[model samples]
Target: MRGCRYQACRHEPLVVVYEDNVVDRNKKRWRRNNEELPVHLRRPEVVRPSRPLSVDQWNQFAWESSQASLVPCENCGRTFAPDRLEVHQRSCKTPLPGAPRKLALQQVN
Candidate 1:
């Protein structure tokens, strides 16, 4: 006969065993016990807002400040926000310096 692998084991096999059903039943019992507690004694449920309350005022202020600081394009005379001016100017039809005017003149000659 083979001896048990564990020194403390009195059974033929030294492995421990647990039933899944017993563990699941214990978890369900714990949840049911907690749910049965008095309303005031239980922890309050947390509610999260879609947008945070604190950032609203700061965001509004920043928008208004940026709108106030808008600069007009010298070539087109159209007002644009500073960040968008460069992109708009790149495609503007107005004659700006460093365009292909010199190349066109050379082609004509």
Candidate 2:
């Protein structure tokens, strides 16, 4: 079969290992989970608990939270508590190229 250097997986007629590794890992995880569950409850279909974030809901909730402590980072654009911002503004050595600098820099510039 033809092979490419940059391509990680080759569809060769010989041994192909990357696909095998994925299948083997999935099989091992399934076996482990199957062993953990009781014999009577060993059905093909089982529901698992997962946590999913809703961006709109989270954003709305965050905006509604107390306005006193949160300030959007002039460097990173992340919202951090005022105390954290205080330390970050003083010590955050990573420069912000395009964004406006914090209040203290305006006087110097």
Candidate 3:
């Protein structure tokens, strides 16, 4: 298959064209979120955040999140699951100038 001439050329940024009715509705939604209207006239706000959790709850959440997260490798600084990081370490190499070099992380305990 042949590629377009523009494939490798400098391309322009995207232009989005929305219809008039859609634009007007989006404008109204923006205004509603920005300008405060009377409670009766206001759209019922669906509150997303729950009441703050206790200190123990917060600690548990932080611990769980840390354990579940994909942490950056010391050498590549790219994220990997702890189990998968070893596999990446064996093969992760970069030759690009100014790119990061991988290093081993020292364990504290």
Give the lDDT of residue 75 in candidate 2.
Answer: 59
- lDDT tens readout by residue for model 2, 1-109: 5558534454462355776687688867866765665453233422222455488866655565534235555555555654466577676566656766566334323
Candidate 3 residue 28 Cα shift, in angstroms, is 52
Residue pair clashes in candidate 2: none
- TM-score, one value per model: 0.27, 0.27, 0.28
1 or 3, which is superior by lDDT? Answer: 3
Instruction: Put down candidate 3 lDDT per residue, 1-109, tens digits, no spaces.
Output: 5477655442332222345467678767756753554332233322222668888987787666554445556566666655566688798775467764544233311
State which candidate, 1 or 3, has the greater TM-score: 3
lDDT of 2 at 10: 43
What's the true lDDT of residue 27 in model 3?
Answer: 66
Please write out the lDDT profile of model 1 over residues 1-109, one tens digit for every residue. 5555544464434232345466567767755754775443233222223465578876776676554445555455565654566678788776577654433224323
Lowest lDDT 10-mer window, candidate 3? 40-49
> Roughly what TM-score does model 2 have, to 2 decimal places?
0.27
Off by over 4 Å in 3: 1-68, 94-97, 100-109
